[model samples]
Target: MEPLRTENLRPLDVSENLWDRIFTVAPLVIIGTVEGNSYDLAPKHMATPLGFGNYFGFVCTPRHCTYRNIEKSGEFTVSFPKPDQVVETSLSATPRSGCSDKATDVLQNLSVLQATTVKAPVIAGAYLYLECELFRIIEGFDDYGLITGKIRAAHVDKDYLKVSEVDEREQLMKNPLLAYIAQGRYAKISETFNFPFPKDFKK
Candidate 1:
């Protein structure tokens, strides 16, 4: 066999936060929380399940209302919007006026439902919903903070649920999933392939 060529490799600078420079696919979720008399919904792409168990987390900044709301209420909700609902997800990020309440302005234009376990609201028509209680907040990372949550309740749309007889890929093709490509881009995930894990592998 011929030796692999590596002469073209070059060093890259890391001064500008390399993660933002790379193109990565991540789940885009709308985070919901209660703000006094109204509710707030914001789109977050830097979020994921903390581990295999029922824990979730997302990166937040102190400047955002989400961080303060979660701190005040001790709970929040996550809604996974479908591919078709991307417009609504984007709308949630609309900037609010200084004199007006952002939660009131944003919630007035969205379809939402009250969460069962938390005081937060969940987006209607979302494929999945997770009601979470504030677990811990790790701050002091420059300006961003890691907000961890313990999932208290979860809900999923019936159509997106897995079934023994149904082919997962086929179902996904019919109802494509939504993905966020970092750097202000989005994608509709309609095709997928099974990973060929080594034999004797166990979950």
Candidate 2:
């Protein structure tokens, strides 16, 4: 006869690294810079960008005012940060912990572009800026939310993106994609692959 060991089980209350767990499962993470009625509630909201081509957007919990502002205002700017700006990008995720009143003070100071379609601002240093309008908002259980926006405009840096010169090897050696492993820690992703999924199974 053998006895099962209950000692192997530790108290499971909360996830040790929820962000890391989600990051591994999620294929991509897009930094969202927003402006709402009360920025005090959530200084900045950064989440994974999910949707189809030309209609790209993000899915986030509805609790935050950014979701409501986008629902009412119908626009937002998805900014992709530069590798060197990782420090400032990570600071955007930190809750209002400093003495700054405006949550976006640092973002603004980073030399960003003013969004035309929306009141929100886009990171000037970003290689691409996706301007979007709220197309649909899917609500579920407590705090669980899914919001989709239609890509209104795309501002890309002509210096970086090019077809003939653009290659995986070039992007690896020259370009660095910002990746969030944990909450604050970031890594430069030099590896990339192109895997197109079925139209019906789009994220």
Each candidate: RMSD: 2.5, 6.3
Best by lDDT: 1
Candidate 2 achieves a global lDDT of 0.58
In model 2, the clashing pairs are: none
Task: Name the lDDT value of residue 119 in candidate 1.
Answer: 87
Across residues 98-149, which tens digit of lDDT does each residue of candidate 1 receive?
Answer: 3136777677888899999898899999999999999999998789999999
Q: Rate the local accuracy (lDDT) of all candidates.
A: 0.90, 0.58
lDDT of 2 by residue, 1-203 (tens): 88867787545436463444444422233334454432321223345456436665455666555565676667777777767866656555555543234455655545555777766676557777777887777777356566677777777776557677568667655776666554445677777677777778944
Q: Which stretch of 10 consecutive residues in model 2 shows the poorest summed lDDT?
A: 37-46
The residue pairs in collision within model 1 are none
Candidate 2: misplaced stretches above 4 Å? 1-51, 97-101, 182-184, 192-203
- Error of model 1, residue 169, in angstroms: 1.1
Clash tally, candidates in order: 0, 0
**lDDT (C-alpha) at residue 142 in model 1:** 81
CA RMSD (A), model 1: 2.5
